[model samples]
Target: MRPTRAKITDAISAIERCFLRNQDGTNSVKDSTDSLSITEMTELLESLRGSIQRAVSVEQTRKPEFDIFLLTFQRWLLTDIARDQALLCDLLLPILNEALPPSASITPQTAPFVEKTLQFVRDTILRCSVAKDLIGKHMIGRLVATAVCVHASTMLKRQALDILNSLLAKSKENKALLTSHTCLTDLDNLVHLLKNAGDVELQTQLVELLFRICPKPKQERLQFIDTLHLPKIFADIRGDYFHQDCRAFLNQLNAGNDGVLKTPKSFRLSHAECVLGDTTSSLTLNPPDGADSLWLDFNTSSLSILVMIAGGDILSIELAFSKVQRWQVESSAGAFLPMTPIRI
Candidate 1:
């Protein structure tokens, strides 16, 4: 049922009165949270989410103030109301949609907005099964892009990398999304990030993500190592790479025919290969068919070769080619490692 204008107005008024109070000339997060019931909070969040999304869709000349509302709303969602999983799922994605500006670049001034986004992913989005695959994981490309955005503050980049690491620790669904075709299409961008990341910790996180999603196929894995061209970086990080968990990760990758770090074979151009990226959306600033960047992606279990064209007057395009090719990927029958999904 459509909400009557009066009903919407009353809900908005109630939300303001409930959440925007200054007692003793100070605003208390606790008081604000306690003022509304879960149901009321859900309703208010939906209403707020709708308004923000409409503003974004319409590309209003004036940017909406959803960012301010989101920071406050997210705090209560993460802490005071953490146990309400349903409300978190219902409200978190829309909050994210509100936080991200359609055409705005991720930069230093965008730190707080990105940080709140990380907090949402850590506390709710990553662990919330309902949001993990279909809704939450889609943030991967955007966050990865932020980690490499030249204009982003070092602080934002580090936090963005940390959020990527956190996403991997949540579940297989999270890990799978990291390797899925939509994400694999962003391989070129990830390549840029891996090469340019200056911070030691940030570099480590990027390396881990890269290796974690290294294609299951031997040839593609070799292609990744060759393309990345950072041969000695990982080897020189002796003390850090030897950590128990890192060692375990390394061991698993090297255990069988699936060894991702194995020496590269000749770079043979093949139709059936995988590259993880989001070129279709990322290359919108340029012109249509501007760059015929060729690569392959695993759209789930299926394989596709794509040439990305950056849109000029129109939006970007992802072109898939039909050609027959085959590469044998060895299936690992090894026992799975003990699971410890951590988030911070």
Candidate 2:
């Protein structure tokens, strides 16, 4: 049913009142002493969400009044409210994902707003199933592009990569979208980020993302690695969490079936016949101490590869390919030895 203008006005008024102050100068929705209990607060938030949804639905048809209402609501989310970040994320995720798609009228004036909303979406998607489900094909490329925007904050960029990691875990279509030429600019930014990432976590995630984007088709995968320019990118990065994997990625590109293992004494060459499916290649290497044998498993999926070492205790270090890397093994020296490939 079409809502009358009076009904729309009432909805707008209800939303506006969420940020309004009482005669005592206390906030109506956020302050407890103003006679708003937790249940009342939740009910009020639900009412405001409905009003915002209605305004968003109306704005789709070029309704100016609802557009104004949306602008006002965005302002409230940005300023008027403080503790309801979850609500803000829930409110903005769908609007950004469904309403303001890549074709939306995002001028310089609105770009900050769009980016901020994406940051919220990035933070929410990890814990909120609804936000995770909102990620579709239309949003995937944009999110990748957003992650590498030169002006984007490190927090936003990392969150964007994190969100991509989650989506890449869910389906191959997301991985395909990332590998396509449409993300050329994104990949460029990714290379830039890889070289310049002061944030260790950010750089680690970048490598994992690159692994995820490795195209499964043999010809395309070779072309994609060439497009990555891994050697040039790796030259600047050293002594980082992804050093060995970066070497392995480069070796895989340069020599299809052989890998290089570096020791203080000499460099040893190892071979593994590159496989034909999603699981691209696996290599096992022996460390100098002969304490543990390292196993490296590479996959084309977004979650990327897992590096495991076997000795007295089985140790697993999952690359940021998924979530957090697991490190459960320690050395007799009383230090936590990171579970990395010996050299492959």
Instruction: For each candidate, give its TM-score against the true structure.
Output: 0.49, 0.41
Candidate 2 least-lDDT 10 residues: 259-268
lDDT score, candidate 2, position 14: 57
Alpha-carbon runs more than 4 Å astray in model 2 = 1-94, 97-116, 123-134, 216-220, 232-344
lDDT measured at residue 101 in model 2 versus the true structure, 0 to 100: 28
Give candidate 1 regions above 4 Å deviation: 1-39, 50-68, 75-91, 101-103, 107-111, 123-135, 215-344
Give per-residue lDDT, candidate 1, residue 67: 47
Per-residue error (Å), model 2, residue 121 = 2.6
Model 2 lDDT per residue over 104-215, tens place? 3344444545554565555443444443334645467667666666656667677678777777775677776666677677788777776555443465677777766665
Candidate 2 pairs with clashing backbones? none
Compared with the true structure, all predictions reach lDDT values of: 0.48, 0.48
Clashes of each: 15, 0
**Superposition TM-score, candidate 2 onto the true structure:** 0.41
